[model samples]
Target: MIHLLMEAKKGRLRHEDEKTSENDTGFATVEESALGKSIGKMELTHDLITAQALVFFLAGFDTASTLLSFLTYELALNPDIQTKLQAEVDEAAKAGVSYEEILKMKYLDQVVSEALRKYPGGFILVRQCVKDYKIEAERDNEKDIIVEKDCLVTIPVSGIHRDPNYFPDPERFDPDRFSDENKEKIVSGSYMPFGSGPRNCIGSRFALLEAKVLIVSLMSRFDIVPVKRTTVPITLAKSVNLTVKDGFWLGFKNRNR
Candidate 1:
């Protein structure tokens, strides 16, 4: 990169004259900051490109790692849930699950969904209000809530995910909450391990797919079991991202497959 800078200064840099259209910066929004949302046309500078690349690597790696840790922790604690998931994956594995097959694995889907609900990698979602918004008071004598233009809005994702009204016995590691019969009962705008709406995470499906595949592969070979090092009640890290502070330690006993 320093060499490129020197070459650019000397007007001898290769591809200096080459132009990439605004659409050419692939996946720039993958790790876009919630607070500093792109408002209008953006310049694709070298620094911007470098920063985004770093964000993609760091954000994707850490977030996925956290999700997997929570997933294993939850599974280890709940042997019943793990067994069900394993059974489902085992069934799917008989034919060597293709990308399409994994999606059709209902129990696996439920397990992953429940895991995200239990421990979403992103605890909060932030949105900038471009225009004034209002929420009418539900009861008389109560005033409506008003949000002015340019105000930043914060949504507590983890809290909503665990809300008793939305999810009964929210702390329970039951995947049935996401089952086909029960999933319809889930309120829209309530579940969002990945952010919802237009500006939501672009890689949400990809992340889910990756997790499903990996979990299936792991479960097919071994059982997720809790060990002495694993925390009884996992504590959230006090960092900007959602993670277990003590780290997610679990045992993997080989299955009798």
Candidate 2:
């Protein structure tokens, strides 16, 4: 990929140099765009651009697949939710599957939100403390906790998502928790499917859009049902990223048939 991008960068530079006007700034590809911006700058190296591309690709690809896998598994297990989501998809299909209409899907958003809550792409979030911070005591029995500068803090995303305090009866697959009325009751920073604050996953919106689009497209023509090989109460694999122990085995039944 880097070799191809380097070749493309050379081609774009050659094309731009041949142009009569130095101000002509049309870029055909992402490589061209990045190369154009970094042409005069020494700090922005080819290695940096390659790293950026890899990060974007890996982060978006794997996480989106993981989200879809878990979401489909949940849907297969809970046919009622699938039926309701299918109805929503059917309603949306009348006007066609445009970005605007998909964004307007309330139940779809809720279902996706619930799936993220249940099985987040990343289990933990790590942040390095820029400066010293103090945690004030909440009750008389508790003492203040001090975190010095450069301390590494880890937030267990999965643990917090399943906490009864934030999500009551957290084990159950409940999309209503994200309903307009009930969602407001959720504690801040408790629902970080893609982490929270400024340094959160950059591809979060795109990832959600991808999941929604796939679900809508698939559920529109087919129903996702569990097969004999389907694993109930999915066994999580021992890895940094979320994975089903034996892989997700689902059956797609044609709705028309």
TM-score of each: 0.80, 0.81
Question: After superposing candidate 1, which stretches have Cα over 4 Å from the reference?
Answer: 1-53
What does candidate 1's lDDT look like per residue over 95-192, in tens digits?
Answer: 88788677777787787788888888778888999899999999998999999999999999999999999999999998888776888898987888
After superposition on all CA atoms, what RMSD does each candidate show versus the true structure?
A: 7.8, 8.7
Error of 1 at 206 (Å): 1.7
lDDT at 239 for candidate 1?
88
In candidate 1, the residue pairs with backbone N, CA or C atoms under 3 Å apart (3 or more residues apart, or in different chains) clash, namely none
Which 10 successive residues of model 1 have the least lDDT summed?
A: 22-31
Model 1 RMSD in Å is 7.8
Error of 2 at 72 (Å): 0.1
Candidate 2: tens digits of C-alpha lDDT, residues 158-205: 999999999999999999998879888888778888776556676676
- RMSD versus native structure for model 2: 8.7
Off by over 4 Å in 2: 1-43
Clashes of each: 0, 0
